[model samples]
Target: MPRKGMRSVFMKSSSPSPSNSPSRSSTIPPLSPRHTFSESLMEENIEIAQSLITKWDSNSQLSEFSNINSLFNGDRSEARQYLNSVKDLQTAMHYFISHNSSSENLVRAQFLMQTAMKRLEKEFYRILSTNRESLDPESVSSRGSTISSLSDFEEDLEDELRTAGESISEVERVSMAAMADLKAIADCMISSGYGKECVKIYKIIRKSIVDEGLYHLGVEKLSLNQVQKMDWNVLELRIKNWLNAVKIAVKTLFYGERILCDHVFSASASIRESCFTEITKEGAMTLFGFPELVAKCKKSSEKMFRTLDLYEAIINLWPEIESIFSYESNSALRTQAINSLVKLGDAVRTMLTDFESSIQKDSSKTSVPGGGVHPLTRYVMNYITFLGDYSEILADIMADWPLTFQSPLPESYFPSSDDDGPFSAISVRLAWLVLVLLCKLDGKAELYKDVALSYLFLANNLQYVVNKVQSSNIKFLLGDNWVAKHEEKVKQYAANYERMGWSKVFSSLPENPKAEISPEQAKSYFKNFNAAFEEAYRKQTSWIVPDPKLRDELKISVARKLVPLYREYYENHRVGLSRECGSESLVRYAPENLNNYLSDLLYGNGGGGSISSSSSSSSSPSRSHGRHGR
Candidate 1:
């Protein structure tokens, strides 16, 4: 609306002027000639200038001068009002111009308005400079309003009025000068025991500056061309600067009234909220690129389990996270803080999930006496301990929130199937990680295929798991009874070793032969015994028994079960089974020789365990043959 009237006035003013007009020639009065009219117009200009100054000083005629003040103050609603009195005056001037009405008076009138406006502007600046004491922070509170330190102050200027350059610039220049003038005011306020007022004034000024900066960062409207041309990185960097500015303000020294301190603090909070709102509402969240960060975690762990840099990243962001709320007695802010933490928790969970997904589940489960555990399992186990070690930090973060919470938040999302036994959500999350790692190890154990070696492998890994869990924070999660259960499970695998490996060897020996037994039956018994003993020996000697104690115990058990059965059978059948092969040949092994062979099977002796066949078919089954001690 202002543009429409201004447009007409501007157009009227654009046409070239003449010194005198024909229309005035016929109507000229007796004494009042063209020169008199010229003098009257020049006087009129001076009168208008004096009236404008009067209105400015009086604060009267606000309604009449609404557009003029609004244009300067940047009040869009008032600035947009259609021009009123100025319109009628310009309309009359337009009529004179259309009839070739310019005379010397019109020329001076034109020059007069410019001269008056310039002079008025000069005095406006002087008065502002003169009243600088009122802008002082001490006087600021007593004065009606705060003069903010603002950015983009001239950005909202009306397009039509941009040509009104001298008037517009002068006003803005004065406002900025007021701020500079206020600096001495600020120092004066401080030196004169008004530090509290100084801080309060600083708060109002900083808010306007921050709010304007924020406007451009995300909230301000832009043409489609502007949007397309925007460099997204530049926008994000600006937002970061605002956030940093707020942080600096929070840490800024403020020895002032609590009210002023509260204001500075509140202003800082509002800026954070605004920046975060931009992130959430405008999808500026991509600025943070959380998914990409999580991907880095995945890549790191995938490269090597020891590259757990996510922990450091979390630590680095703690201060940002810490500054989210005041945590002073406001329940709503406390609630807000909790909600923010939940969002942060989601981020942490993403990093952890990346870690989990990257682990090579098919990797081996090796645990020797000193070291052999999988790195992921070690990392997972140690990380769980780390969580426990710092759980209090998390607790402190949520402590205020919990007091106002209606129901507790879920600690994890593992979604357990067992309904009866309730575990802490944190415990479940950790357990899931540990068990997934163990499942990977279990797959590796099956690779051995040998029943005894598979059992040995499983035993070693499970033992390591149980021992580490029991000694650390994990003990609380996995209960004390879990160790005994796992130990018993390991023993079952060992029991399987006895049944599959050694029981068949014992089956070959039988009770003593009766007197009625025929020679053929006795020879059959002796031949069967020789075949079974040699078969079991060759198969088992090369098997690894990493535990030396277990290896010795197995050997002793086999010896105790077999020796007596052979001794009883030897007295009854020795004479009969002997004659077929010479007594020497019949003695594949004497009782004592059998004892020695079982004792040495995979014993600690360092030779690569191959049982060589050394037959003595001609030797008698007697003391001399047995005593050879081979």
Candidate 2:
């Protein structure tokens, strides 16, 4: 629509001359209004059309193939004027078609417009190609920081350039200039009805950049069959590469490209959106679709951590995915990302189920030597402890995959009510896994021949579990209360081990050490205590507690229970027994000898105490003293 002022100007210029005007020759009949208007419009269009040819006739040598000079590079004002001339010629062509369709001026205008578009097409391609580094997505996106409304974008851009001032580097200046040039050309070409040419060039150049970027990031479009056929080692390396790539892809590469596309084609909303879609859609799909392919591959327990890592990477980058691929055309990219997350979550859940099943199905009947930590105990505890690192993500993934046990776990197995929080699901899941291992361990413990060694096996394995939980991220997921409860179970096992292993020794001691007794009775008591203590020590010489803290605690617990009472009994009965006995060896063990014997237990060193030796002495002075003092 022409403005009212333009309409008035056309009307005035096309107004008919007075019929009786003296300047008009009588033979020259007055012209009709239609004829006069058509002639006036044609003349006006001829002038407008003439401006296009005149403006560019001198610059006609600056063709698409001219490499020495750029139409937009030298003078900012001149470039802007060229755009206005093209716009004016577009308006002229419209008027000519409505008023004088066969006019040569329209042909000229059309030709010049093509000439201008060709020049712009060349500029667009040149700017994109030559300024690759300056106009990279990262630089462009960072300059914008966050997308502002399109209406204020030019203002924001001006403020940015103005603020950069003399401190702007040569690359930054080139980038800003290139951006302005490209946007100007895009706006001019689109207004002149050459948007397809401009957009086609843009898509070709930018899509290449995007494709190359993804290629360098090690993202590839692997089919499910290819991924399935891949060896685990190769697939694992790919997964690690993807884990590192997804962050940069979402945060910088794709994000920056979106910003640049939107900015350059700001004049056309539909063009920018479509261009961004076509440029980034395939690369993004391939990037995000990898996890789903990996999930679809042969599932295994060993691959669970990598699957979880993929899931975590996607979940963490979701905000960027949503923001950058928000276009309706690019919804597939968003859906692909979501689908990868879902598949990864499923893989993780499946791996969890398989792991738990493997634990319960463990059929090893061989008991651990000397009641040491079981291999299954070490494997499962180490695995679950690592699972604790992903507790936050697991909570989300496991929200739907509830723990389903045939029978409820024991109350002691549950974390206290105060331990409940956001990660309760993961905590329960991991806790259930540990419980599965424990039940399996229980079956393994029954294989041991000695009931006392069975208790010791349970204690050693559970102590390992507790230590693993405490040392890793599992400590936070399974709270202090859970740890404390398990620790108490370990204590109970240790206590049972002591009671079952040393019952005879405890029974051999007199009820009251200070009671009056005959020398014969004292000798019998001394003889019985020596036999029981020596037998217990000999039997437990090969037992082991691998954890130093638990080992020391168990030693202290046993020594505290046995040592003082034996010390009192020996002190009261020593002289009377010595008087009755033919040799002093009957009152053989000094109180310090008990401490020495206890030190040798649980070390897995099969050496007996010095009870039979003529000289009974402490081999480890510090260890003996510490045990005695305890």
Candidate 3:
């Protein structure tokens, strides 16, 4: 009676009755687990189960929890163990419920499966809760709660579970659930001001995870400084270990959610809290103050090596500090790390500026307890040297930025760069910092009461900074153009010094034979030359230049400019000049003498020269660049 199309459809769509299907027939060979219900049979079973309810019978089909043909057992412990032992519990339950069972029986199977999962979940949490209670603050402290100690404790506790006949995996599953619970507890402990205890558990998890094999991933939770004076090596090792644990927890707990579809308490986010201490309640957003600690350490170190200034000693240290920032693989955490560094840099800049401005508040404010170099100059040098130290570190920080970045320098932190120079954004930033320090130095130099000494100090320090930058790796960061420009500034300072300090001597030199001087004027000229030459030479011989090459270059520069003209003027008019002051006595420097004079230009001389320091020469001690030579 069926239509032709309906008959064809029925033949194709219908599955054989349970008695007729090849798989269902007792005569057929068993499907060795790999064989499964066809799609239609699975759909038919799920559809039947969705439409009815069956008895929650604890006997008959539910009587065993063994092989596939075995039924579920009634004992709760055994049922709980049954759920725990299966590698794919959900898959097993789904297959059992949807393969040829009546709809009502399939529903009953899902209910029993869920019941077993809940029982196991409850038992797991119960055991771990007891373990946590036993690890109260006093107990944790007594054991000294190291990662290894906690690890040993975890092992021993889980061993007890194994002794109770739980599988190794079942104990671990329970422990993982406990660890998940510990995350919230740790967060609460931290939030409630029991951060120290939270740290203990954090270490426990971290150390526990090392064998878990994860930090071929990366992971800070602290004002890194608060613990700086602590044994950082041990703390660092623990941090690395803790990072591994977090990766494992995140992955594993995520697995629990996917496989068991249970309320797996993931502590992965809270795991971060255990890594570092925080100043505020903002959790992981706390800027790790380690980078700032590093910045401060460099500033402190500058006091020990004051003469060399800032950058030389500090540059080597940046690598270690920057590594702290780089170690945090989490992008959000790294941003906090960078903010801490920027805060440090800004703080340092403020320090330098405040120091300089305070000096200016009353130039007569007592000098700090150090020798020779003026306190103001020392302050400027420290800033220059220390900032020079910071320059490369900042450049390194900036190096991660795009080369095309045109972002302005961070507030009070970055240095000036030569826009015209071929350098990266980082390079430009370094240049800007250098320029800022130099500008401050130049301003301080201007404050010197003696116009000539101002030029001299400025010239020495500027040349020193330029040479330091050029000789170090910072040179490339600053570019050749920056060096050249600053070198020109050094020269400009020297030129100013020359015009202001030496012009009188050059003026006193005799001119053309056509312009005859009266006897009074000639005598006056000789007297003036004696006064000027002796004064300049005596004042500078004892001032320290420090660097040999800089010393030589300045000496050569003086000779190149002074020797030729002095010789020309002396030769042209010596015969016409007065001998009243005595030519030998009047001429304090011969051409050869000039060579010795200039060679000792940068270093302070101990008044060692052929030039006489007669009663005519000023007796005042020249204290501009002290004899603190290296």
TM-score of each: 0.39, 0.87, 0.43
Q: Candidate 2, after superposition: displacement of residue 473 in Å?
A: 2.7
Task: Please give, for residues 379-448, the per-residue lDDT of candidate 2 as tens digits.
Answer: 9988998888888899999887777768766867866656557888888888888888888888899998
Clash count for candidate 2 is 0
lDDT of 1 by residue, 1-630 (tens): 564564455445445446574443354323435634654554564455445433443234533652244223434332112112222223334434543354443454344334333323333344344544433223332221333322222233234235446653444444444443333333333332333444443444444433443444333433335433435555344334434432232222111112222322233444324323322222112222322222232232222211123233334444543443333432343343344334444445554566666554445444332122445555666666665443433333233331222655332222233422333444455556665666676676666655555565565555566666777766665555555666566567656666666665556555544445777666666667877777666555554454555556656766776767776676677766654655544446656556667754553233323434334332322222232245
Q: Report the CA-based lDDT of candidate 3 relative to the real structure.
A: 0.45
Q: List the residue pairs that clash in candidate 2.
A: none
Question: Would you list the C-alpha lDDT of every candidate in the order shown?
Answer: 0.44, 0.79, 0.45
Comparing 1 with 2 on lDDT, the higher-scoring candidate is 2
CA deviation > 4 Å runs, candidate 1: 1-348, 351-423, 430-457, 511-530, 547-609, 612-630
Pairwise TM-score winner, candidates 2 and 3: 2
Question: What is the C-alpha local distance difference test score of candidate 2?
Answer: 0.79
Give a tens-digit lDDT track for model 3, residues 392-470.
4544444444333367544323324334333455555445545555566656665565576677777777766776676
Best by TM-score: 2
Query: What TM value does model 3 have?
Result: 0.43
